[model samples]
Target: MSTIYKSEAGGREIQRLYREALDTWPVPAEHLRLPTREGETFVVASGPRNAPPVLLLHGSGANTTMWRDDIPSWSRKFRTYAVDLIGEPGLSAPSRPPLNSDALALWLDDVLDGLGITSAAIVATSLGGWVAVDYAVRRPERVTRLAVLCPGGLGRQTTGWIVKALLLRPFGRWGLRHSARAATGLESPESGPVLDSVVATFMHFNPRTERLPVFPDEALRGLTMPVLVIVGGRDAMFDSHETARRVRQCVPHATVNLLPEVGHAILGQTEPVAEFLRG
Candidate 1:
């Protein structure tokens, strides 16, 4: 077991649960493992093989399961590949290449090549959004369309939630649930199962602590592809207003959505994002 988890038992549990989630995937899918320099990459492929390709990247500490709610809708129109980011709590290898280096971009290049793709649309969230933006900036021609949600690297990241989460850590499961709620804004009774899964994961998972390198205005301006950025105004993580302003000013042609009531986790964007990807 990789040291990304607190212990071997915890690692086993996380994998078991992930497998269970995979078993319950709502659509017909093919699980594939692609060899890359970063390590073995895991992808769940769905939709018609001949349809246009759409790459799905999940946020930090998450796996392809993050797209489960949206895949059914997205796969209907396009071939969707939900990639389990390396180093996250997923089936992928635990190879965490430095974010400041070009390693991740190269890893993604290997991923695209392995998928037999020359160009594809990308839908990513949070850390995955950072990955997509980095790749677009480095290899703009390979990305057909770009859509991101609450991604890092545009606005300054906040540590207030980190302090809050740390202070509440010793209180056990209740504390963890509150911490999850504080970060994600999923507080209703209906969000219990979601919160429970988050708590369960954090019980073992060790999330990356490095501050994501912020992209310069020059880098943001290099995104000439069709772009869409969706962020939460009340996000406890990144400064969404700054993110929105920068995207508007830099990528003037980009579509930006700022949801005032939402937080770091932006939910129910399946149809909106689908429309953007369709275009």
Candidate 2:
């Protein structure tokens, strides 16, 4: 199968950085490679053996390390599995599946089954949020509770954001950094290191081009688990207010929080998420 990375050398560099990032986990983690229909899936497991399971799915172009700051707190309360979604820039298989189909849901099922988890709470961000919602709608019995941060599929993606992103692509690292800050709503200086990492990945990896498929109202309404939705009022990728409104309209009992000061990148939300999971 063809690799998703730009080249073998670039792939190796990303892998090396990924390993280095893994070492920075706030808590000791067990790295496991589980066989799935897609291929081998990589997982970083932490927390107590007897605790309830919680799955952490990251955004596009990110791996399990996206939760480096959030994992320590989550792992303390529940057995946490930070999964590298297949076909992303992680150690997982590079098989790109159709986003509009049930492929992601099936892949998630394989991962959970391999981990011996029959049911788990899901905390997902951005693109990962779409995957979590998809799985929940398709296999509601397997999802205990769902929490999403600035997730897609709830509202229409902004064309302006796409145009701006495309325009910035040719300007090299500087332009990419600007695009990252704009997309994330993070200040460049304070977000420099992380943005640099993001740029590095973007340069070396082949990102998914397909836009996220919008989840239908019926699917949104089908989620039987307790749901928590958080969005940045200033998010550039999608209409955060609209997304929150849709969730509230579809799932009346769902908890929705709109942080006006925040943007597409949801950092420092681990506390509230942990509380929701514990509840």
TM-score of each: 0.98, 0.96
Question: Candidate 1: misplaced stretches above 4 Å?
Answer: none
lDDT of each: 0.93, 0.90
Q: How well is each residue in 186-276 modelled by candidate 2, as lDDT tens digits?
A: 7746767777778889788887878899998998999878999999989998899999989999999999999998889878888999999
Q: What number of clashing residue pairs does each candidate have, in the order they appear?
A: 0, 0
Which residue pairs of candidate 2 clash?
none
TM-score of candidate 2 to 2 decimals? 0.96
**How close to the true structure is residue 164 of candidate 1, measured as C-alpha lDDT?**
93
The candidate maximizing TM-score is 1
